[model samples]
Target: MPDLRFQSQPPAHTEIPRPKRAEGQWSLGYTEPLNKNEQSKKDDDALNVRDRILYTYSKRGFASIDPADLRGRFRWMGLYTQRAPGFDGGKTAMLEEEELDDEYFMLRVRSDGRLLSHEAVRALGTIGVDFARDTADVTDRENIQYHWIRIEDVPEIWERLDAAGLSSLEACGDSPRPFLGSPVAGVAKDEIIDGTPALEEIFDRFIGDPAFSNFPRKFKTALTGHPSHDVSPETNDVSFVGTVHPEHGPGFDCWVGGGLSTNPRLAEKMGVWIPLDEVADVWSAVASVFRDYGYRRLRSRARLKFLVADWGIEKFREVVEKEYLGRELVSCDSPPSPTGHRDHIGVHEQKDGKFYVGVAPVAGRVSGSLLVELADTIEEYGVAGARLTPYQKIVLVGVDADRVEDLVTRLDEIGLSARPSQWRRNTMACTGIEFCKLAIVDTKERARDLVTELEKRFPDLDTPITVNVNGCPNACARTQIADIGLKGQLVMHEGEQVEGFQVHLGGATGLQANFGRKLRAHKVTSAGLDDYITAVVGNYLVDRQDAESFATWVARAEEELLRGEKALTPS
Candidate 1:
């Protein structure tokens, strides 16, 4: 594989047709002239990247690939050049931006709706081992990431995945990524609706379709019929949460414009009930609205959430109904607030009399060979299916009562613990400096260490806490909503640079969903992270009144006490 140096060119600029403004109401009307950057982003065809990768780069190998294609175009085909393994002290600060892309690539495979069959899973595992050097990680978005890939082998990998009914198209880039749905969609006993049919409809109709290949930026969608808010509706661009109307037995309530990054905002409800049949249409309309009317000037503010924030849910709903749906949506009752942990960890009975065993992989990191082992186990059971959860977990569905014990024992041996401890189950970590070019510090390893230390120090901790560690402010691990969110950065310790994290306290979801507030002047070096968190949790355990949640305690605790004394000088 040659190291190709493709010249970087400014993206093309073009004009989009303007929409007619509705009188006395706000709409996504293009009232302002487009800037050069905005024009470049919109005028540039995202679909062109695909042909270029397929014909030019694939034929000429890695050396002929252009830099522009490396960053912008390669993503259309779900290929990202990963950082070389040995670089340390965070890629962002350690090396020049252009030097970040080594010979290897991280291939993101779209597990649309988080649905995977036995054959597909097996095929993915094989690809990971054969092509990716056994490097694989399950992302928070329910996508499978494979590293150590080269340009020459990309076509063969695609063929293998396609043969198993999987795809990597539109998994990244400006188009829609993997669609999130309930891991227990069809089998959950407490579900209001199955939601699989709707998910399949949207996937078949829109995914990989050229009409939706281009957008201002990446778009995220989630659909779930579960009552526990298992799919995380409020944090997605478009979400359809299950609800039951008094007149209509069951349907979905719509939400729009939820996202997290440097600026975080929860999704706003549309107060409209969409029947099962209309879900796909509603989804398409929302994506079309984002593509046509979403802001294109600033890439930073181009997500659908920004548009929703400016328009307000009411006005946004009106635009969708009038311009897209051409019919008014029925108003319906809202669903109940989510209760308890929705990660679906541990074993539980499904509606089908069989069982589903949810297992947590530590920090969502698993080897390719381990995936193969799990796939073999699934085949042995001759079960219905398996799915990945938003919690960085996996659920083996449709296991009979007779096979549950044997499956659990086998899973435990493979490090996929069906009944993991709180540290193992609730802890989540994002790809850090090891593979991510934008990362400021190492996250996966640090998170694993923090979990281990916390478990040892606070063995009797009964209250649940979600510990999310993100390598950057992008919030890939959803640091904003975790009970204790750690955002990675570089810090000076004893006059030398060291890995550190900024602390965010008290973020909770469900009825009282809110982003965690940052703790001022509170930074802890990676070496002392364990001690600092242990002390903080120790304070919470001592002061908390009557089984108060960790987030609740952090909300009312004095800042001085919350920060703890040991954090004053982290060495």
Candidate 2:
């Protein structure tokens, strides 16, 4: 018979201490593993079999608890709230203190029209939850997050979130990430077709698919009808972009390979075009190829691009066709002429007499109070709803035309603005070292600081310059796709090395998806980094052609020349 007795104490030698690093070296620490006896005690203490599995799995670093166990763990607690109207009756809940042991508690929100309320935010905050500061982030899709949740709080938290219309699906790990579509899909003036319905359809198909849930690597997919490339379909692993074919019909231009990390690469176009009606089939086929052929053993090299690289593009197409259609697949017709970029900022006249006001929320940081204020304002104005932008901004859609000025004033009072100047329109950054363990610097704060200084120095700079800053090489800021990219690094300062950055230039999105080139490395000291950016922008503004943009100018400059110019500029 197997040993059944549980030990009262954890086994000796379970915890390991960190090795001493030399004074100048950077060190990252790892948690020590628990002994078998301690693990048994933990399992015995678990509230249920599902809780036991979660406790054990978390100890093993996999976080894999069976869905049945997940449901069982909360069933008796009344954590699963009723589904929001028009939703798929998915379980939604808030974390109780005991249930939140991981760095973050995963909550599923009602994807159907429900948005989180201000009261919900405050309730979480009053209970010592700090989503905004504790790496709370919004996914490429519209879901908001609150990480660093303690295990014990999981059940109660789930209950609260359920009451607030949030649920828990496969929000993390190898599962397909939430399907992204144009935030303004239904409201955009130039939309050929709203991609939301299709996005929802694909989302419903894959969210709990066993095959997708346990895939080798994370998969991200996006859809966009807006010509502005606001959803940035090119940067996702698989993308279906809304476009028109000259002779065929309305459809999506399929693309693959775009990702951001240590080695950022823009996705390459896979097929010429895919008709709207066949998008699901095309997506399924492409996913099947990735599922079968993608690298599974190596975590770092598991993205679709690596597969595309190992097997040449033609070979990849061959496999996709064979697996998807079970026969030869013919290329579709070419896409139509491209339309100019459009961002739904300022007051735009909707097809209806109503207007949509775009509000820029710097760094996407919104408190519970702010969220409540915005919702109340929306209610008061009798607007349709709010739309989140890829650029960490928000749009209040369908506001009454007569109340536009009043609405704008109210938004400004709450620190959200509809005004878009050259600098504020497109600045983006990642969470940096302040919260993300992998980050090397404080990117979001630094980005805002950098932009504020640049505006002061070059008051008349009218060009739209996108600056992206990632805390580390992971490139969460999409640094590789910006006009100016800054990745965190360590630089020697006063005999001791501190956090700094390696700067890159020239990257741009949309039709001109080019990787930014490394321009200079600068120490992020209080006295110097700002001056470097000012000088670089000033040089580009003064030297480039009349119509040439900042990116184009940076692309043309020699690396050495750019570095020297930046170094010479004083703070």
Candidate 3:
């Protein structure tokens, strides 16, 4: 018999307290053991990507770009291998790394809170037309993703975006990504305070700075003074939610360690009230804590959430205050509870008496041509500007009441709808096997098809339900918080590998924040999704009591009834 003693029972001598890790300490092992010749490049690998960009990529262009720099370093500058144009539905799952990669690139433009000047929006539209094959997407992060970029055109793209006062720098890196904010941060009628200045100040100071360029893993930040907590503060690593400080008047309440993905966690309140002026510095301090002490040994456990989880909120706060902030934060009131819907859809009145029309672009999909037309229409209507929402929607701000009708008409003409059906309005999908490498199935078009049919079937239905679809388990579309969440996977169907999804029900945000519970043994094949959803939703319609939300109904309903055994087809 093999001596199978568990590793948990370590030798007595090895049971000492582990040495404290140095600041900014991390160790990432190579994917494969290296030979003598390859081992020499270890030093080069140790250097940050900033060196490679200046010395290698800038000088060599695409032809002479190093392999490590191509796949890994480029992301530090917001570049990724996009699916080539005219790539039909082939190789849905990237079993082999090379199977999904391409020479073309996808460029992400960071737009914090969808804040952009009219000129910037127009410039983005033009860039999409000229470079991205007319394809553009308004991401859930309030950023824009453009596909079909070539490495050769990078410098020019940077120049054009720079002229618009926009940047792709550190957009998709291990460093802190773009700060998410409420679309109507400064102008919303119910806002606690204008947080635009704090967001802008943080962006101006830290973004692209070498001091904070490297991190154990990606860091996410969100700041919003909106009373509705419009940025989904509970789902980010660092968030400053709006709250009234009784004695101090308007200030922000802090939340930390919130994240989604393989493991989802709602943020914990830090019990500290941050004054408006000190928010930026506090934000920096939080980020500095992540940079200095965040786990670096294993990428899987490197997120700040893990650290926060291990240390608990109390110790984490102690470390942040002692090691980073060097001052005790003021204890303040809790964050304001979300009031009503924060989706920000439909035409609404702004604080300034001007009308703001919010429109959904069908799962965040929009073409360059549509963007151009929208820009022209906004200019024609004399609207102040536009803002992107975290809900994968856009809001046209500063529209006069007289011009609202014209703008709505123009928006409808461009295929953007202010009055979208509930199915269309609530449906969201991630970049699936269509472009994402980790995806196991299609999402965008599939979601669009599902929404189209659902709307047609129940045209007059008025129940509020969010249906989120993801390409994989990463939860980029926030599948966990949806009424009906579909996580993509591959299964054997009629002797062939076909797309399928595991369903989760009853997840929601706001006061009733909770992750959806996964259905027991209910996997719906892609071909049968339409019928499955219809049956479940139809069942909800029949059984639900007076004005009961879908999430509430699913939560109370029995698992067997919710599953609808007759509706789901076997994979």
Best by TM-score: 1
Better of 2 and 3 by lDDT: 3
Give the TM-score (vs. native) of candidate 2.
0.76
Candidate 3 deviation (Cα RMSD): 7.2
Which tens-of-lDDT digit does each residue in 306-392 have in candidate 2? 767655667666655553455444456423334223446688877677888988766555554566567677777777777666666
Models, CA RMSD each: 6.6, 12.6, 7.2
TM-score per candidate = 0.91, 0.76, 0.90
What are the lDDT scores of the predictions, listed in order? 0.81, 0.58, 0.78
Error of 1 at 318 (Å): 0.8
- Flag regions of model 1 displaced more than 4 Å: 1-44, 85-96, 566-571
Candidate 1 residue lDDT tens string, 30-69? 4333454334334455557767776778889888987767
For candidate 3, write residues 389-496 as lDDT tens digits.
777889888889888888898899889999999988888898887777777788999999999999988898887788899989989999888899999987668898
Ranking by lDDT: 1, 3, 2
User: Once model 1 is optimally superposed onto the true structure by TM-score, how far is the C-alpha of residue 230 displaced, in angstroms?
Assistant: 0.7
